[model samples]
Target: MKKFLRKNRMFLSMCAIVFLLLCTVRTMYKFSIRDYHVKTNKVLGYSPLERAMQVANYLTNLEMQKLQKEQERIDFKYCGGPCRFINVLYIREQETRAQLHVRHLAFTSAKVNRTLVLPNVSGSHLGACKSHDFEYYYDMEWTRQNKEYFNSIRMKDFVAWIRERKEANVPVSDQVLSTFDLDTHVDPSAVTHCFSGLTKPKSTFNQILKWNITGQTCELSIQAREIAMVQFLKGPSLGNGMNANEDIEVLHMEIYKANQWSQMAQSDIPIPYHPAVIKLADTTAKSLGPFVAIHWRMEASKNTNNMLPCAQHLISLLKRKKKFNFFLLTDYPHMFTQEQQEAAMKGVSSTSELSQWLQSNSDSFLMTDFTREHHEAIHYLYQHDTFHVLETEMERGGTPPDHWQIMQIPDRLKLADVDRPRMIDSGWLGILDKLIAMRSVHFFAGQKGDVCGRSKSTFTAQIIDARTIMRKSRTNYFGPKNKTL
Candidate 1:
């Protein structure tokens, strides 16, 4: 054995060293892997067990929250017993009328302790009617937070509640909605039943709460039904009808009065323009420094003859204020007007009279002056189509004649086929105009008189009221005197 050991000693020593080296390498590798995993776990702040526990806790909380929401929905729908709801019909004209209608109804609902079903604004045109969610135009979060001021639900939610109730075999009141069209010669006797025969008393409330159109005293009485709908068609009478003198605990309600219906509508609620609108308006207004806003409603002026004269007068008034830039908002198609077209044919500068006047007089801006990005933002919002046909039908008192045909068409195709005019020509563009005008240093709108040749416009009224609420200057350049300017 000693002889064999001596013969292979060198080889034996080499094998031992190699074996030790191999073992050391293996040990280092194992240590590195263990250290890496330990560090990773430390960074994550949790072991496998802790992670599993966290996941389980998250799932449990999610399920609990969902259950809580469902319970709340059930509570709201059932209302602890027989459910009572007051659904207001949408005023299918423009944003101003629709907004005012909802505001008045909200006040009435809060006063009578009924859940107000708010109508979604219609984005329909001459060809097709498309319903948009209330949040599309206004801040719904404000309404949710201001439940103390008024308890209201979206028209869609109300429709869903009604459907669920019907499916559950719960009895719903089929009482016909009391609708009044004040545009026609509505007898006081016909609408007096709505007030339960309450006469317009010689009270301070009566003096403040006069109807906008008829100049009659505004009054209302709560209906005695589980489900009641009151629709005031045409004008701001519905909004003016609310008892502004009612002793409400809401702090902002103090500013509410009959004449200042717009202020009341937005009082504590501050239902500002939609976030997208504000974003767009802010972008545009940032570029336009210290500009005056002019809203010229030439399309439907009470006195069409006054429109041209009014425009000339407005030009003169703006000329006097030479230092300020001008932002003109008009329904008139300046590019497509007869005068512009004729000028284009005659090899003259293809500009409308108003456009030429504005260009020659002051640095003027229009919706067309918006940048590509600004226009793109507007288009993006315009593409946000919401289908609330079921809700709309319910709110409108009955389904349309072509309901079945409309239902047959797919929602996407329906939206695509809808004849949505250009943003400049569309009624919805007025929303953007209003937002921009509200931010202006000065606002001038057409008024009802021979001097202005403009009709009484709710659009102008709303903008002025918004300016008032914003504590901006109320200086307007409407009349011939331009005294405010």
Candidate 2:
């Protein structure tokens, strides 16, 4: 009987312990749910639970935006914060042609993001739903081993970097984004996904212009014109009492030396000299001391029938009296129409017409200038000037093939790959070609030709249009009465 009583006592004690465990678990779960609710209110005041209730009852039509307020609040651009934003920006765009169209919108948006501050200042190129062009690949990284610029970053590392930045500005304590349905929880004020389009920069930008940006996530379909400067201004905060409003004198003659247009690119990392340009310049100066470089802007601006006649007259006038050397730096002569080609042939021959012109005008002491460089140089070429034709095989005799060869060697390093865009039909070499022509005693352009610019460094050189020289008809406009090479 005593043994039975002891066993009953043990059974009772076991029941009491089990009851205590149940109560503890229930209490803990209630507090956990309460904390989650509080966090949600702090972030996005809208409750996912309320939205879910609406979803369960009916699919509210967009036609009734009054009832739309009853529907789920979705943000396509937010992409669950930074990690997803970067992934979509870099990775998802590579998936399909349709996706690339979206990428282009993002690229143009980023370019014009700064001008958004101007009220009523509108932007476009956003109406099209589909486009074949892509411009986001501007900042390329050349890989030594691969000999290419196809570079990428890891998602994990990207995520960490974004988290660090957002932590300072975003409040995670409140939002409760929706998940896949009945089987899930819905939160109108919470988001775990985001997107980007027409922004002024890449996803790597970490600086936040203002706090409270967490609840203000955007959608991917937002128009480029809709973007405001206040919506996205995330560069380094202005300090040192400097203001963005300060408009300093715009100077960019040696911009290549001061700022590199690359990610993490350092300023003024010593570049190497282009061997061909150097060799050509040195050889030309040695062979022909001083000469005039006349730029013929035909084809595009050779109209009013003044370009060819004016150029020929100027060459004849200069050769007859001054006995000056001359060189032709015109647009593509080979690409000229038959009528245009014939007119050009009358000016100077491939050493043939030039030799005859010199013989007839015996006193003409002339030679063309082709070499280019600087006074103080420890071997450095900022521009790829050696990548074009040394001389054109046009109407006037082409320059010496030994020195002024057309185009760089067949296998030289080309700037743009077959895939990348180089500013519509023109390449980096086109700019270099125009620049090379400008470095002469007298740089001439058509009545409406593009003159590039006269450098402050090229002190004694003069830039003039063909019409002005033809009108003046004298060596006086050639500049500085007593200048030497």
Candidate 3:
């Protein structure tokens, strides 16, 4: 028995070592499991993998919320609605009157809780249907910031929304685009709802669904599923008994009444010139140093038949204020060269007389007298490719075609014939004149029978109104009681 035990001793030692090692491994594993559970238990009773999943879910929710907030902000700025819209058509009017028209329509939109679709601005009365961006004439940034006063979206944005609706298969009834000429008396009960497949003519959205106002009345209210587009045939105007169209005056009053109902202050209405134009005017005014601006408006004057008296009256007025330089803004052919002036005089005898008067008053500066750099700046800022196209088409001895046709011409070919250096177009030049006249130390306009006599022109009225709003007066420089000469 002792010999057998000695022989098996090696085997017994090997088995014992194996058992001890297994026990040590099992104990170590058990402690590791317990430590892992303890660490996990401290973290809201979740295992490591479960806790990681929980953190991922929390971050995802935060991201989702952030995306939602961003969408809401975009919706507010661009007016992504669940809402209705109103657009104005400023046809057959100059830009000054058109600007007022827009303001009145914007007020109407605000009062009715509708988004105003800003109309395209026209630089020429002839091209009333042809339009440029709202920014071409006014400060769009100012408009955006002052959304509380005028809630609006650009013409392009409105068009995009319409296209999106069509793509999304929004019901034809839901996407109704209608036009209405607002009546003098706004009867809330006279609501009209129109529906049609959208037809955009010449890229003007307001002309989208041309429905005649043959029997329509003042108010146009659409159903919850529909959108409304209202166009004004005649725009709101200030009623001073100078014009017989009291209908516009009534419309203007309705807007004010709506404003009163909505608790909007009249002071909140925005000024109508582009910020760049205003800035340029202010700078030029400072450099001119106490100059008097005279808006002769010879084209509108009734005294054009016998302009010698009118010119004499203006000359005498300037003689009285001889201490200050004169800035003349007239519709006559004042910017023509000697050869051009002679040619123009041959066409219009009255223009020749007005030109001689303007030429005699050499102290008076015309817009052409501005620096070439300043003229270039005006050209660059307000010049549109469309203007160049129109001018080119006109110079070729043909009436300019529709906007779309003009745009279809290759971009390279449009400006080939245009004289890019000169501010030749009346559209941009009118704006430049307005801004310069607006910033003058003393402003003078034609009164009926005064030297610069004419009917009550919106151009003159706008300048006076702007000056009043800006608190521009002769009193600022210890001058006379009247702000206008």
Candidate 4:
């Protein structure tokens, strides 16, 4: 053999190499076949429903290429229950499968005789579970019939009934409850006592009491009032009868308005504390930029309950941004508690006060005097050093105003005529339109005064000059035809 190998060493070596390569290729092909096994790849050709079951682990074993059935044999070794059964239902809708059975489902409201309705099962649906004896008992005809006692029935049937009732607009009440079988005559006290004994106190009375007293007190007090307000202000819930888009649009408008007001508060320039400097700045601020001063006044009836709600609304809208320094010039500072007032001013950048100056008979005899104070604020804003009113009267009058926008006049109204901190003019509407069109700023205040107080001199003075500003204006700035107005 040694002599033969020496004679044909190259030929023998070549033969050995070819044999090793063939063996390696064969081994690799076999391994590749095992790696790409059907169990690993899953059925790419199955229907969507078939694929879903496979993915969900419902299919246990493939009996044939076409007939794959779910593995329903739950391992009973875990529980000592008497028996088990696998109940399968074929559902046509994707929704039914997603919401599993046995979750919201109740088996029976009562045992043998007395039946009662289980209302808790109304909106909730069933969930899937695996068990031993429970499954066998659940499969029994007697057990299925007894489920009516608990209002726990087949989820598919229950869903179908619910759908019918929904289409009929039948209310969920005793009538609806009657559809389910419940043992009304069952003595609940014995069972209830048994369950009660098993239950433990969740927490100490003191802990729960503390939370109820403190945590929920604010919400409880205010939530009831808010609900009442919604009833009073917004009317009724029209439900599905109302156009959803229209409702959303109106809500959006309110949200936008609120946000804009909040933004205005942020942009508002505040007066410096120094008297001379404050005075100088107030006059110059408005002049430097073409901005308007908004003098807004909120009034509640004397000894009225309106103060809290009104203040809450105002504070909610005002706190969004520190756009403007709100000189909350008010008459009844006493109406709100100090804490409430402080809360309102928490994020407020600055506060300036022009006293309400209520005279001895300000309510009636000196009503005019109270009005003067409001007008003075407008004048203060127009020429004040802190606010810069950029637009000249001629220019302002000529320009069309948006719906809620306004501009002010300087040094025209007397101190006695200032009624509110701010005033709105006829030109305000047009001004608001302009602001909306330009999206220049969220809001601008032209003048702040009582609209009802027509003959009132302070407002009249500003309105008179504003009318002249309107007259000299190239556009019909104050008229209905004005685009901004």
Candidate 5:
């Protein structure tokens, strides 16, 4: 073998060189796949509905990716100038989603540290959604929780803040915000088309690379780089990852920090109940001991006389065991506009039938009675809200409303002033109603959309109704109907 090697040394050296070259090529290929998740890539569509659903997950995954990249390149610091902050002002469009978006975006910012700032969202886009109320569940819960964050700056103040930073030689992100939509046209009807398997947005990191839309895009060249902020602003669900990455660990840590900073105290953002609401709840709890809290969704569907059946079932279930007070929190679809009610109920029984049944049901408490009782709460909330608004204004270096200005603010709120927090009173009232319902002993909820009802019932005052037991003891559920094994 030695003689043969000596004879073919030239051939052997050539073979070794080829082998090394092949190994290098293979390593490069593996890394390229690692840096860009090719398998997870897909086409993204331009639909508002898809946009809303995907935004949360997109932001979440983007933060995870960016955090990972930042850590990987931690020691590889660039000698670039002072990094900039691109404040992504929280805008309350459809306020429910808007609040969620704010929270999600904040979480992303915390993890990625691209220095994204969220401006306080002002104004509820009332009557904006096709399938919901004028001022659907926009509440003070988010703003109150993030009071410190919102108080940080205003629109003009933020602009000035960025300007000052720029002057002081601090890099401020020029590309503060970007929309995901490749094309601007949002055909409301096209959302349905996208879902019909006909179209889907191009959903890939490479696609984002193609578009070059992100905070880094403000600073870095739009070659072939992954910008975490851009990934968040756009993209569908982050393709499911198999192995948990270090980015996830950082994300969890950031989330913990964020929660610690923003979780509101019960007293700080109290359920906007009038003194009478507390009085009513206290009086009722004292007299009735413990009751059942059930939220009926009759307002969602006209044929949802399901509430009547559920109520009767509740009564039948509890009547024999104990005299249970039923705190029923429900929406009157009939109260909505004709289009809204129709959409909610989809040609169910007229409001009169449901109203008549509710009126006749001696066991039921009327929503109107609840409203009359909580009028003081509604009134008090306005004063509380106006006070906060003034405080915010004052914080922004603006004049606070004078005592007379506050006093002159009429007890009666109007549609004209709906732009402000006055319209939010209804949302506050709705939350109060839900909380009251949850204070019940045993809850009876409609079987359909069981998740919604079950979620509410979990807060019951054994508090564990069938639903709660199912949620907590459901693993024991399949085992036996027996409690004690």
Candidate 6:
């Protein structure tokens, strides 16, 4: 009797524990489902799906809102965003070859979580569904579907979408986006399981701005465009109050359409309207032929008072025979105050308005000022009155070789954080080739935090024993006479 009672008690305890576990699991499931469901309410406090035909309809509306905001900020000639917006969505009419045609609508934030359908946009009226283009427009609504709106783009809006979800502490699973397309009918799931392929930048875009720092030292920044400014502002060092004058330089390259008549006449195969340009070997500064420009960005450091170590770097460049022209474009006189101006050139401000004025008027100079420490560089261009750099090349000569030789070389070489100048060869051709290929903006700093470092301390000089060498033939490759060695 005692043994039977003990067995019965053990079984009863086991049953009780299992029943408690079941209850806990049921409660957890209920909470998870509620969490996963879309909860944001519409104007009348309705759910997104409740107001839309499908999930995509709701998301497209979200995408449209984001695009409107982006469009408002785009200004290639002014704000200088990274890439320009190309209109993709359009309705087509005739299909001669019995082809199919499709059209896409822009999505926006104000219309997100709504349903959108086109009237008379069926296979019969649109001549079959062929292909479509998409973009998020942010504020517009569909002409047909008053009850629903378009959904935001799937992978294309990854950066914006992830940022919002992260802020709200929402757990957006990949399943939420697994079915959406990138832009056209192409699905994102074909490439990756994740909705966003975006990873953290190795160097944030905000670090590229010239004016974001607060350190009193002169600073310099180089960027491709104004969107680059936003990138720099978003960096980890943001709001650190480092007010250093900096240089923001951009190299602008562009393509131009050749005369259509010439293109049609010259081809066995139809020639493209624009072709990549190649430069010929020449010493003259003239444009050689029809071509476009490929822009680059580079930065230089400045002193605390917004002065440049020009003499030192120039001497080096001249001696080194570095290839490429050095055009000093800046807001020279206007950006600096009387005292600041005096300090820059020891109180001799001859070109008070040259830099800034040129920037405002020059094709090569953009709107930003490049004279101050916050915007200084050897090849820095804040603005350009003329983007026709290719024209300059065409008129100077068909084209100079992609690289030009600098006349002089620096005695020493300096890279960031290094104390002493390093020995480097002064072969102008080789250096030019490298610079053209890499198009990199380089900086050198000292342990004491001198941005450009003191020139004398940074330059490396070669000790030569003149007594040992024999005389050699001379050449003036870049001289007015164009003499050869």
Tell me each candidate's TM-score. 0.50, 0.30, 0.48, 0.17, 0.33, 0.19
Q: In model 2, which range of ten residues has the least summed lDDT?
A: 250-259
Write model 3 residue lDDT over 250-269, tens digit each, in one string: 11111111111112344235
Which candidate number would show the highest TM-score if scored against the true structure? Answer: 1
Clashes of each: 0, 32, 0, 91, 15, 118
Using lDDT as the yardstick, the better of models 4 and 6 is 4
lDDT of 6 by residue, 1-485 (tens): 88887879988899999999999999999987776553434334666566675567768777777654554343222224322111111123211101111112122211121111211112211111211111111112222232232332222333343444344333222211111111223322222212233222122121111222223211322222223322322223335553221111111101010001111111111111001111211221232122111111212223423233432333343444333333221112112222333233342344554343233212223434344443342222222111112112111222222232122233333433236543322121222222222221211112122233222210100001111122211211111121111
* Candidate 6 lDDT score at position 91: 25
Off by over 4 Å in 3: 1-79, 124-131, 144-146, 168-197, 200-272, 339-425, 449-455, 469-485
- The digit string of per-residue lDDT tens for model 1 on 66-87 reads 7656645654654653345555
C-alpha root-mean-square deviation, each candidate: 24.2, 19.8, 18.1, 28.9, 24.1, 26.8
What is the overall TM-score of model 1 with all chains considered together?
0.50
Model 4, range 163-275, lDDT digits (tens) per residue? 33334332111100000012222221111111122122121111000112223333454335334322322224578654212221000000000000111121221111113
Q: Report the C-alpha displacement of residue 71, candidate 5, in angstroms.
A: 31
> Of the pair 1 and 3, which is ahead by TM-score?
1
Q: Which wins on lDDT, candidate 2 or candidate 4?
A: 2
Best prediction by lDDT: 1
* Superposed Cα deviation of residue 14, candidate 4 (Å): 4.6
Better of 3 and 4 by TM-score: 3
